[model samples]
Target: MKLSRHSDYALRIMIQLATSGDALVSIRRIAETYGISHTHLMKIVQSLGRAGFIETVRGRHGGLRLARPAQDISLGALVRHTEGEDGLVDCAGCLIAPACGLPSILAEALEAFLKVLDSYRLSDIASRGRMLRALFDISVPTNP
Candidate 1:
């Protein structure tokens, strides 16, 4: 299943912050590092912030950081937050909507997909902290 670019960016931002530890990361730097639009990334960041995944600090010295530990952030939870409750198919307009089994089958597929994601925390996916930091030119936590 393909996730929206918005969800994709949110996950990337989370991973970046997870690897940074307590360090505040600038949105501009993250955008540049990922070759993504700053404006686009800003919107994703705002959504993640609203969902309580990340915290925004205001001030000249302020930036963004994870609101909680990486281990507490589940991939399935993040996907749900970003994707909302929209169904995979719009059977409302289909002629066979009343008896079609496609919707139920698709729903089962989605459930299985999310079940796999639910098994992993951000910590599991962000295990390559040093590698990610090096690729982004950010300093890796010596103690991590």
Candidate 2:
């Protein structure tokens, strides 16, 4: 399935924070690393904070960090929080809803996808590790 750019950004943000170790990272750094707009990244940060996935700190040292360990954060949770797709297609406005099995099939598939994601956490990603940080040279903040 094709994930939206927003979903990709959310995953990128999570992976970055997971790999950063102990330091808080800024949205600017994340946007730079992923080559995304700072303004868009800010919106993602706000959404994640509202969903309880990440915490925001204030002041000069203020930045972003995972609310919990990487392993504790599930990819499914992140996707749900970020993507929020209930089905493969937009069936709500579809003219035919009762006859089509598309909605049911899509629902099952989506559930299975989530079940697989639920198997892994941010910690798993961290443990296995990825080279996302090097891709953009994102430096973790020392102060926050």
Best by lDDT: 1
Model 2 CA lDDT for position 10: 87
Tens digits of lDDT, candidate 1, 29-103? 899888999999989999899999999998898999999999999999999999987779889889999888999
lDDT of each: 0.91, 0.81
Best by TM-score: 1
Candidate 1 overall lDDT versus native:
0.91
In model 2, the number of clashes is 3
Candidate 2 weakest lDDT stretch, 10 residues:
135-144
Off by over 4 Å in 1: none
